[model samples]
Target: MKHPVELLALKQTHEQCLAHADALGEALADMRVRALDAASYEHLDKDDRRLLDQFAYRYTRLQDDMGAKLMPAVLRALGEDIAAMPALDRFARLEQLGWLASADDWATLRQIRNAFAHDYPDSAQERFERLQAAASAASQLMDCLGLISRQMLQRFGDLH
Candidate 1:
């Protein structure tokens, strides 16, 4: 039998990615609620805005890292040609395998991740909006990835 160390490592990484993705999703939801309350109640204080901005930045980075982790595992699971896949095509294939919801949100999340990582000095509000969308998509992606990981584990038996 194959040693299966690589498969086991990929599975572990997938689990970690899902955990971080879920945490980021929860933080984003909380931030969204706070944002809505602030809008309804009054303008957010500078400190509150800063907090949201920071969370958004961190969450975007987390999602990006999770995606990077998931992609290689997904390629291994499918035994497919990763290079042949376009961004959307890769997402779609994952979605078909129950590893994602759809390509649209995943693509948007990638864009948001790029913006947060590279585009500095953008308004807090803009970043917040992007984060909100990315968070929702990340949540869905987490669910799908978690399911895929579980299935993989079952197929190969538990990793030592």
Candidate 2:
């Protein structure tokens, strides 16, 4: 019942989401390593701080973009009303679509995103800890997205 072109676009977006998820996983691992190293040093050198800052920025940006792409795909596969659904309803839809286990963690991640976007400079230590936590949550979310993409491909077959 879906148009072939639309399906193709969805497939492409799904693939991109999967790829971004992989990148996020890698970034999360890197963040953990950096956090450990920073902790071991007991103080961040200027270069170390800069690296952490850059990594946190890129990790958050990529995670947000992945979510942005995913929302559109969900709308395409389901319906536009999904955009306006309550958080619980949205989570249920995402779960039904096999894209997430639950939405609770995602809400936390979104809060972290908002914090990073709006109030990152309150304290370096606090921001670092927040970014680390966000990285972990984003990693899990990316895994869910990857699973959904796989399920979708299996259900719909390869578009190309």
Candidate 3:
């Protein structure tokens, strides 16, 4: 905490992650308006299909980047000693500290993410279900990011 350089580095990294989350949240909002529910997948037009495909790609990337990169960096900026803990324990601690809603929610997000990653192109029903779920999860993930961002601002003031 005494080292200005170290603090500056963390602030910069944290800001970058916050910016990415903000961008992804905006994209998700746009996609949500155009996205179809699972019940309507069979009715999507050609244009809708194109839009949905783009949404699917962005959703998966946003989910992956947030979990793999952004969350850990944010945790570190918040003074979490993540390097010493296992991933599950780290998430559990974040939950305990109110950074995450629950460890189980984090686990569910991971499962949804994995489903997206292994999706079969030939299975329309499965793909539609996964996209619908991912779209829902994207909003929840944004809420989590918002909570983390608020806590960061309260703890560190303007991170910029």
Which candidate has the top score in TM-score? 3
Tens-place lDDT per residue, model 2, 68-137, is 6655565566544654666566666676666676567666777777776677555556766666666666
Q: 1 or 2: which has the higher lDDT?
A: 2
Superposing all C-alpha atoms, what RMSD in Å does each candidate have to the true structure? 4.1, 3.4, 3.1
How would you encode candidate 1's per-residue C-alpha lDDT over 1-160 as one tens digit per residue? 2346557666677667656666666666666666554133246777666656665655665566556666656666556677666666777777777666666767776776676556654465665555555556556656656676676666666654
| Candidate 1 TM-score, C-alpha based | 0.63
- For model 1, the local distance difference test gives 0.62
lDDT, candidate 3, equals: 0.69
What is candidate 3's TM-score against the reference? 0.76
The Cα error of candidate 3 at residue 18, in Å, is 3.9
**Candidate 1 ranges with C-alpha deviation above 4 Å:** 1-3, 32-54, 81-89, 120-127, 157-160
Highest lDDT: which candidate? Answer: 3
TM-score of 2: 0.71
Ranking of models by TM-score: 3, 2, 1
TM-score of each: 0.63, 0.71, 0.76
Write one digit per residue (lDDT tens) for candidate 3, span 29-123. 66677656666776888877666666556566656666666667656766777887777787787888787788889889878867877766566
Between prediction 1 and prediction 3, which has the larger TM-score? Answer: 3
**Alpha-carbon local distance difference test for all models:** 0.62, 0.63, 0.69
